[model samples]
Target: MSSKLSDYDYPLPEALIAKRPLPRRDASRMMVLHRDSQTIEHRQFRDLKTFLRPGDLLVLNNTRVLAARRFSDDHGIEFLFLEKLGPARWKCLVKPGRKMRLSATAKIDNVPMHVEEILPDGERIVALAEDVDLYAHGSMPLPPYIGRESDPADDERYQTVFAQTPGALAAPTAGLHFTTEILSEIPHVFVTLHVGPGTFRPVHSETLAEHPMHAESFSISKEAAAKIDNAQRIVAVGT
Candidate 1:
């Protein structure tokens, strides 16, 4: 039977939603839904180590979050990097869309950034000031749901220890639960998928199939793909 979007809807109490990270990354609870037994197993996240074998592969997205928040004397602007179109060009979403003009300049922490062009949906193609590394100047692009300003600790906690790519605007939350100790116990490979704001967009369609998945730019090197192909099983952590 084809499932509609409403069919997949489940009630989640506001209290159940995690608002902050646990004292430890692996301290969160885990719920394993078993279809055959029609049962749910309540377990701690750390117990995940017990369920895997040595050769199993865990594929994770390692795209680091870019601090895309910008402020000025009179206005505050926020942006999320969508994709890297060229060495210095990126498709990005800008806030206060009505106030920002095409081919204008926005100062990020006193750094002059020129908006080369604008897209249909408040997106802009911007160029950073010369001799500046955009990644270094950018802050961790926190989700709007966070409802708070980004903190210094977010610079490290928001990224994986192995994160090498600097493009995603948001961290893959599921992967945030993992620790080096847990990763060391399991064989894993990292991949890059520069997640955009679309991932957090509300589902407006009536049918699940009618809801299109965002097209993300992902790269899996031959070596990583070979490792995944050779593994006994593949475990995907997050959506």
Candidate 2:
């Protein structure tokens, strides 16, 4: 069935959103839902161990979000890099799209970029003049709802403890609540699903069916797959 874009609209009060991560990763609150009993329980993230048994497998997405937001002072432009196309080429979304049309280019702080192609979705295939160190020069691409500029603290807070694989534009937020201590106590498998910019992109269509789903790259290790197959039940740790 089709759903209108407006149908998904709900008021998200700013107070309900978290401006910063908790002091400890496992210190966050957790809501436990019992399907059979139709009851709900509130607990700390560390208490997650109480709900699982020996044969239960916890699968976590270990994809890491890149520090992909960069500002160009020369042209007063901001680039949110999405994908790497080649050695020195990337797909990026440029702000002030109204002024920076096709063929526009910018050179900011010795990092040069040119618009190679304009995609149908309004993103640009950008060619870098040289290999740019996005991690060192760019800021974390934080969600706008957080209502603040990215900071040095976000470099570690926004990432999961097990984040090894990179390419995600956004972190698998559910994984953020876990700590090394919790993972050591559970039987777990790690999977990679590099989150895309679509995590923050709103559906523009009137019907949900008409909205195009964004694609993301993912991979599973043989060990993880074996663990998944051997487990009695699988518990996805992240959304």
On lDDT, the candidate that comes out on top is 2
lDDT of 2 at 197: 77
- In lDDT terms, how accurate is model 2? 0.86
lDDT of 1: 0.74
Most TM-score-accurate candidate: 2
Q: Model 2 misses residue 61 by how many Å?
A: 0.9
lDDT for position 228 in model 2: 95
Error of 2 at 106 (Å): 1.6
Instruction: Return the TM-score for each candidate structure.
Output: 0.82, 0.92
Candidate 1 accuracy as TM-score = 0.82
Residue pairs of candidate 2 with colliding backbone atoms: none
Off by over 4 Å in 2: 1-8
Instruction: Give lDDT tens digits, candidate 1, residues 209-228.
Output: 88877677789999999998
Q: Relative to the true structure, how large is the alpha-carbon lDDT of every model?
A: 0.74, 0.86
lDDT of 2 by residue, 30-104 (tens): 999999999999999999999998799999998888999987767588789887788888888888786468778
For candidate 2, give the lDDT of residue 195. 90
